[model samples]
Target: MNISWEEIELYLRHTFVTARESKKNVKRVIVKLEDDGFYGLGEAAPSPRYSESVETVKNFLNEFNKLISENMSLYTTLQMLNNLNGNYSAKSAVDIALYDLHTKKLNLPLWQYFGLTSDKIINTSFTIGIDTTENIERKLDEAHEFKVLKIKLGCEDDIKIIQTIRRYTDKPLRIDVNEGWKNLNKAIELIKYLEDNNIELIEQPLPSEMLYENNRLREQTTIPIFADENCKTFEDLILVKDYFDGINIKLSKCGGIFNAYLMIQVARYLNLKIMLGCMIESSIGISAAAQLASMVDYIDLDGNLLINNDPYTGVICKEGELKLINEPGIGVMKIEK
Candidate 1:
C-alpha cells in the first residue's frame, strides 16, 4: 500500500463567529492510501487550541505510514500513535482514515461495523454564532429552512439573543457557551432564561476543566448540559459523569473512531446522551462523523458542511441535515489528486 498526505484550506461561506472567536478558514489534512487498485481516503483539521498544526500532523503521518508497514490494525494504530503523540488531531486523522480503509477493504459500510442504524437523514443544527441580537435575528431569518438552531453564547445578554431567536421561530434550540460562562451564578441565570424559552440543551457554559464548578452548575439547571472540551478521553469520564448530562464526542479530539466508539459505549453505560460532533472539515470528515451520528442521541455536524469551499464529496447536508453516501470508503473523492 502507498500513502500520501496533503493540507488544504477551506473558507467558510459566511463568517463563523463563535462565542470566544470567529474563523474565516479551516485547515485540513487529506490522507490518501492505495492497496493494489483499491483506494481509501480520510480527512482531519488542526486547531492550535487543541495543539495541532499542518506541519505537526504531516510529521505524524510519516511516522504513521511507517507503523502501518509493521501490520498494525486500525484499533492498535491509534494505540501506536498515542504511544507517539499522546492523542492529538494527528492521531485522529490516521485513526479515521484507517477505519475508512478497513471497511473499504472488506467491502462493507462503516455503519455496519459500528452497528449504527442506517438513517438516511440525520437532522443537524444550524449554528447562530455570537454577535449582536440583530445579526443573530438576521442569520435566523436566512437560516429559516433549518428546524433546529444552535446559538453560541458568551455575553451577559445571551439570554436575550435566545429570546430574540424565539420570536423569529419556535424551533428547537441548543446553545453552546464554549466555556464562555464565568461562574455558577451567571450560568444558572442564563439557564433559567433559556429554559423559559424552551431551549433544549446548553453546551459547556463553563470551562472544561472546571469539574466542581460544572457539577455544581449542572445541579442548578433543568436543561441538559453537554461537555465538549472536558470529555476528550475515557479517563476523564468518571470525573465528569456527575457534572454533565451528555458528551460531545468529536472524532478528532478523542484520537479516532475507535476511541470515539469507546466514549459512546461509556456514555451509554452511564445513561448519558451522546452528541456526535466535528471540528470543521470538508464532507470527507463530516461523513466520517455521519457514519456515527445515527448511533448517537444528538448530532452537531453542520460545521464544515456550511462552508463555501469544502473541496470533497461523500455526503450531502441540506438545510441543517446530513445524508451520507452509501458508497465504499466514506464516498470521498480527493479533489487535488
Candidate 2:
C-alpha cells in the first residue's frame, strides 16, 4: 500500500466572506491511495475554525500511513480512524479513499452501491457570498442554472442583502449566518422578516455555543432552522436535536462517509431534515460529498462549481440538478494536465 498527498490552491469565482473571514483562495490537500495496480483519490479542505490546515492534514496522514497493514478491512480501517482525535479532514480523506477503492473493486458507482436512486437527488443551491449589491447581482447573473440560492447573512445590511437578491429573481432562498447573530430577539425578528419573503430555511442564526438561545429562536421562528457550526459529529447532534429542525452535514466536519452515513441514520431516527454540504474544494471533494446526496433533503455541493480550475470530474451539476455518471468508485476521474 502507498499513500501520498499534495497541496493545491483553489480560487473562488467570487470573494467569499462570512462573519469570520474573507476568502479568495483556499488551500487543500489531495490524498492518493495506491495498491495492487489500483489507485483511489480523496481530498481534504481543512478549515481553520476546526484547527485543521494543509500542514496538519499532511502530518496526520503521515501518521495514518503507519497504521495501515496488508489487506486491511474497511471496518478495521474505520476503527483505526475513530481512535485518532481531531483532524476530521484528514480522516475524511482516508475514509473516502477506502470507500472509493472498495466500490471500484466491486465495479459499482457509489450511489448504486449504497442502493440510492440518482433521480432522488435534489437540486443544489449556488451560494452568493457577502458582498456589495452590485457584486451580488453580478454573481446571480453567473448563476443562471441554479434555481435555489443560499445567501450569507449576519451583517448590518442583512435585510438589504435579501432585498437586493429578491429584486432580481424570485427563486427560493436559504440563509446561513455562520454563527453571526448574537441577539436572540433580533434574530427572531429578522427570521420573521425573511420568512415573509421567499426564504425557505435559516442556518445557524446565533453562535453555536448559545444552545439556549438557539432553542428559543427555534421555538419562536416559523421557518425551519438548520444547524451547521452547531452540529459536527453525532454527539453534537444529541445536544442540538431539540434546538434545530435539521442539520447541515459536511464530510470534513463529520470525519467521512462512514460517519456521515451514521449521522444520516441518526438524523432520520430523530426525524430531522438532512442537508449535505461542502467547503470550497475541487471536484474530488465535492464528488465525495455528492455520493451521499440521495440520502439528504437538500444539497450544497457547488463548491467545485465556484472554482475556475477543478482537477477532477465526477458528479455533474446541470441546471441545479446533480447527476452521477455511470462509473465505479465515486465516479471521479483525474484530469490530465
Query: Roughly what TM-score does model 1 have, to 2 decimal places?
Result: 0.92
Shift of residue 144 alpha carbon in model 2, Å: 2.0
Residues 1-337, candidate 2, lDDT per residue (tens digit)?
Answer: 6788899998888779987789889998988888777778888988998888999999999899998976887788889988999999999999888888878878888878888777774799999888999999999999978989999998899999988988999999989999989988888888878877887889888998898888888787678999999898878888778889999999999898889999999999998999999999898888888888888888898999988888888899888998887788888998999
True lDDT of residue 172, candidate 2:
93
TM-score of each: 0.92, 0.98
Each candidate's number of clashing pairs is 0, 0
lDDT (0 to 1) per candidate = 0.77, 0.88
Model 1 steric clash total: 0
Error of 1 at 151 (Å): 0.7
